[model samples]
Target: MVAPMSVWPWGNLGAFKYLLFGPFLAQVLYSRMGEDTAKSSWCLHLLIIWGLRLFIHLLLGSFGNMLFLNQTRRIIKQGVDFKQIDREWDWDNFLILQAFVAFMAYYIFPSLADLPLWNTRGLITVLVLHIGASEPLYYWVHRCFHGKYLFTNYHSLHHESAVPQPVTAGHATFLEHLILTAIAGIPILGSNWLGHGSLSLVCGYLVVFDVLRCLGHCNVEFIPYRIFERLPFLRYLIYTPTYHSLHHTDLDTNFCLFMPLFDAVGNTLNSKSWQLQKELNSGCGNYRRDIPDFVFLAHVVDLSSSMHAPFVFRSLASLPYATRLFLLPFLPIPFVVMLAMWAWAKTFVISFYNLRGRLHQTWAVPRFGFQYFLPFAAAGINKQIEEAILDADKLGVKVISLAALNKNEALNGGGTMFVNKHPDLKVCVVHGNTLTAAVILDDVPKDVTEVFLTGATSKLGRAIALYLCRRRVRVLMLTLSTERFEKIKKEAPADCQNYLVQVTKYQAARTCKTWIVGKWITPREQSWAPPGTHFHQFVVPPILSFRRDCTYGDLAAMRLPHDVQGLGSCEYTMDRGVVHACHAGGVVHLLEGWTHHEVGAIDVDRIDLVWNAALKHGFKSVSAPRTTSSSKSNFIS
Candidate 1:
């Protein structure tokens, strides 16, 4: 490089000072010489240009970058894992090449005397046309470098820093450094080729350009996703730190430098980038903006889940501060009551997938499944119903179907009690007795002539008795009193009065071959049925503690046999493959896109409608009609 000095007579001593220390000398001389000196003489302009470059890139750029990095460390204390930091540190030697790249760019363009001062047109060319023309050229070069031969031998070295630092922008080999220099020159040199560019414009562009380059590798997310949400058109104009991070993590994607236009044109943008943006948005300030919709869509305990299911944690946080304040006056009274209820109850939501269809559903617990437990004995029955409904709604459950005891005891006018108590709730509630009975009746063995229908005194029991009566099966109905029994008999379908047998004693139903348990029965020694008897339980969580000895489980409980292929983790709470028809009826309503509960009397047509829905949605019988277990699992036995 010093060979030039040997040729010129006075160059030897001058070359030593000017070539080596030109930028430093320029900085000092320009500071003292003033602007008039720079404008008057090209010699002074020459030194000042080098001086400005050194001042901006070496001094301001480095110091501002350090401050930004330090502030970022303060903002996020739980930084990357130790092993990742160590892995990145091992590649620190690569960043030293950056100065070499910068040195090449500084001297390679032209002598100061050859370059013109910045004109307005040249500045415009550098700002817009340079980026526009360079982007496509750089995109292709990047794609070529990603190819197998080039990637293995050269480009892969730059990818060593998965989470990059500011200095990592220039962490490339000598060949890559040349490639980087070329891509960077496209705007400056390409514009100069078109005859509108100046060295002043190129130098000025580099100063601003390096800021974005360093910021891109800073491993910081400085852009808000909502900015793109509001002004999506600008997404083409900006490249976030997250954008460049994607380039590192997903090596073949997002190859464009400053904008996404070519990447979109090439169709190589990482699909996960948008998803990651939404996840990042959730933690960002936009959470407050989404509160109204979340509050509107959320439920306490939803049996049906939708695609727009609200975030469960968001819903929990959305619980009004007023709710806590309302308990304040009552203080220890309401507080102690809640504490008592907590001791006595457990709450959970169970999800089921593939539904044999496009949708999935969840079952929230603390429900009145059966009478065996003290909670189901109506101790906290109202609270349980409220808890389930509230949580399901909070989970973004669109609708809830009150099944078994949830219908009769909690709300007297079907679901009206719940509606009145929770007027603010948007989750639709249904008694679902009509379709439930229809589904249950479909489970009754065709050969069976008699069914011991418990809870005959209630609306659910009466509905099932009618379905059985339609089938001409003898129904030995149990009622709480003779008065309720006579009322049901008179209200019952008159065509089969002789097939209906009213009994006050449950023991009398023992002679019946089949049982319809719409209500929970206590698990006393006398309550257990004989060996040949089969049971269809409408109740959930069975009154019995899941014993194999309990004569027949809910035959009405249907499951999707093919559902196992896509069930995923939602199968954790399922028994064999069967889901309770009552709990499942809500899912049926959801799949059918119905928002109301066809309950109270009985919707026989709805029964047929949902039966077809069950078949259409891929629900299959979990076991043989009278089989002791299902092939779904050994646990069923």
Candidate 2:
């Protein structure tokens, strides 16, 4: 339970806490517009500090994620869960509070407004004051917080994140942070009082402090063991992530803030700290490095959606993906990252989670979804997919599922080329289009005897057509290619062959209330459907909702089983704990221990079987929030 003293006055404000800075921001703007430029730097200083703290926190988190992916220098093996992400979501609250404190300090000591840009002596002053005053002051105060009274009320909130990330360093209760801000301000304030202070000194000292704090909590070992081995006394001067991690795990040892020297002097240092540091540095620690049972091969949807990757923004990634106006300024960064990936073109693991004691990971091809449509990109995209599949095969992965574009017919014949090329491979290559078809088919109402279908020549379209025909449901297959339509119709049983009809015009489906869109459709084409027509889509970048009288279904998706753990990030635009049907399809294959390759043509006969397996495994169909109870039951049941 949170103690009354620890609760922030404006804690409930959340994002609205920025409103507190409005007065300060307005002052800066007014100063910039008028002749009063003295307070401008000071006001801007507060804003810049907040921005820098946020930047470094995100930067370190991104770097840590990259290390986790490369699997070399990560100190902790466990991924951050949704709870930790949400807990650290308001990490910048302290920065905003600190700005208020600084404003009060400046009001009391107006001389601070006239500081020099640089002071050589200020560096020495900051170093001496921080070491002599701040370090020991923090050590004793930190130990006291661990006592029963404070631990339960205040300190425990910060310690909640066992496997800490960069943002974790700033996640503390209001009272705990109030004490910390004083400890951090000592050196800078001392330097100012001693007449050795400079703007550069304050900025430089704070930035370094933020960097080291983030580094210690980053859960990644970066300091080489050789550094401590070369100079034995250095271990006591500076602490590593391993040393600080022990403080969280052991709860009684390694209590020094950044310098282990105080811990040693206080006799609170963990004896195992040096050994664990050695083990992590040597890359043979107890950290988990197990091979995943299944891999979901996915690609970036576009420049904007790319930022939804787990490494970019933990808070944004935790929710379903959508374009945010604030993210537009950072679009160029993703463009640069995309170009960098293109230069180093390859597949890399982006995120992973565990379910039912099985490891599953999502791997990304460097190419974006739009690139798949470029004529020149087809070969490179195929090559990356092939390499990912081969690597999974070599790693003894039980199954690898291809994303929509990866299994495009024009790219690699729905992944048939990879399976046929390596016919003897043990790993199951799955397109997962069977489950995609099943999900779309399940959404159709039972009484609907006739349905309109688009993209009839594609793999999913073909499977859907054949499956519906077998049910004696008349399928209006929209395609210009009669030859392709005839081929799909011939695959159906002789008795159901008459259920499939070829149509080249949207006018043919004017009366059909159920429309399955396997391809993109224009607003004009969508208008051809009758009023109240419900559109079920399997297309990437789903079609627009144009008619108020009609409802549109979301892309095929399923909520993961209740047992899923460490699934902090959403899959693309899917909701938390929900994934595209293709991804779930691959997982079902792994759980069912199916050894057969699910590539090439989707088995129409296995639609019900796969759907049943998904249901048996507790996977539920995901319906749009706007779907009414009557509409939801028609699809979900």
Candidate 3:
């Protein structure tokens, strides 16, 4: 619980808090545009300081979240939650607000503003003042904040996050940050008052401060213990992540800022800090992390959406992904990384979470959605996916599900090639389309006697057509190939065969009020559907809602079990706690511990079986709001 005094003045401004620098930015732009380019340098300096503060957090935060990193030695075993993320959403507001103060300081003290770019004396002065005055000041002030009255009113908010991450370093109350600002400013301002200040000195001090702060809270012990082994006294000179984690767990010890020497002097240092650091550093190499029981083999949707990975941005990954204006500047970084992945051509872990004590992970095939469409990229993509499956088999993974384009029919025959070639494999390969088909079919009204279906020759389309035909519903399957249509019709019972009718044009559905679209359609094609027609879709990149009068169903999806934990990232465009039907299918497979592989053609007989299994395991269908009619079809416009 946050005390009333701990609340910030901005009161959870979120991303909009960056606008606090707008007035300073406008002045910088105006000065740069006019004759006084010299005055713009200080403004630019302040902006760079602000930017570096944010960049350091992102760099360390993303690095710590990478599963390939030394995760075995992670301080906290649990994942971050929405509450902690929301609390730290405005973590950088302090830097922006302080920069505004610095901007005013430039005008008040012309000597401080017109300093040289570099000065050896200024650097020396800052290092001396930081060690001699600033460090001691911060250590004592920090200990004072832990006192009962101060802790309850101001310090408890920072301590709310027991499982710390990079941003947790800045997650403090306004009054606490005001004191921190003074601690950080003393060395630089003291240097300026002594006539040795320089722009490089301020920049260097701020960068080093952020680096140390992020390192202590990053949760992952990145620094090697070999250095301290070589020089034992250096342990007091520098503190590791393990050192700081003990402080959060045991609030009475290890309260120094960046150095353990101060804590030692104050008699508040934890005795086990060095011993635990050695244990963690050795464990990183001596032991392996826990293997996941389930893996979701996924692919990148697009260039822009690639940055929505958990490692990249925690806040952005928590919500349904969209193209944001603020994210445009960061595109070049992912572009370079994308080219490297394309060249490497391997499957890598993206993120993971736990459900009912079983570990579930998501791994990517290092290819984008467009690359899957390219004729030349199919073989390489399949090879990577096949290797991942084989690796999981060796590692004793119970179930591995192919998601999105990984299960594309033309690419690898819905993962049939791998399963067939490795017939003796232990791992259960799942296409997860059975549950996907069930979710779509469940939306069809029981009273409806006829429906128009597009892309009827596709995998999912064929199953829906056959299932409905068994119930005596007339299925107008639109396809150019009569031969393919007959193949699916022949699979149905002899009595139900006549219920499947072949139609090649949208004009044939002019009077149809129920349309199931498995393929993309334009406004002109959609015009064929009669008014009040509910368009049930299984299409990728779902069709546009050109007609407001017509209702459209969302792609098949299901809500995850309530027992799910550490689910910090959204699955593509799904909302929090919801997953695509294919993803839910994988979860159901794991929970049921089914032994057989779920690959190749979806079994129409097992559609109800899988749907019932999903419900039995507490997964619910993701349905939109509906207006009831006499027909009883549930859909929204």
In candidate 2, how many Å is residue 225 off?
Answer: 1.0
Q: Model 1 Cα displacement at 552 (Å)?
A: 0.8
Instruction: Work out the TM-score per prediction.
Output: 0.44, 0.95, 0.92
lDDT, candidate 3, residue 117?
82
Q: How far is 623's C-alpha from truth in model 2 (Å)?
A: 2.7
RMSD of candidate 2 to the true fold? 4.0
Better of 1 and 3 by lDDT: 3
Per residue, candidate 2 scores C-alpha lDDT tens digits across 1-637 of 6576687888777566778989889989999999767787788987888778778888888777663354556666667777877777777777888889988888877777899999999999999999999999999999999999999888898898857788888888898889989999999999999999998888898899989998988888878889998899999899998898888889999888799999999999999998898887776746536688999999899999999877887777787777778789989999999999987868988888889988888999998888999999888888889999999999989999999999989889989999989998888999888888888888888888999999988999899999899889999999999899889988999999999999999999999999999999999999999998899999998888888889999899999999887788888777778899999999999999999999888888899999999999999988663332211100000
Error of 3 at 541 (Å): 2.5
State the TM-score for model 2. Answer: 0.95
> Which has the better lDDT: candidate 2, or candidate 3?
2
- The clash numbers for all candidates, in the given order, read 19, 0, 0
Candidate 2 collision pairs: none
Tell me the TM-score of model 1.
0.44
lDDT of 3 by residue, 289-381 (tens): 768999999889888899888788877877776666767997998889889999985788877878999989888889888889999988888
Instruction: Give the runs in model 1 whose Cα sits over 4 Å from its true position.
Output: 1-275, 282-398, 403-413, 419-427, 522-530, 543-551, 560-566, 569-573, 623-637
RMSD, each candidate, Å?
A: 21.2, 4.0, 4.8
lDDT of 1 by residue, 4-91 (tens): 1112222224213234435435544674566634323443443454455433333322332232123232112122222332333222
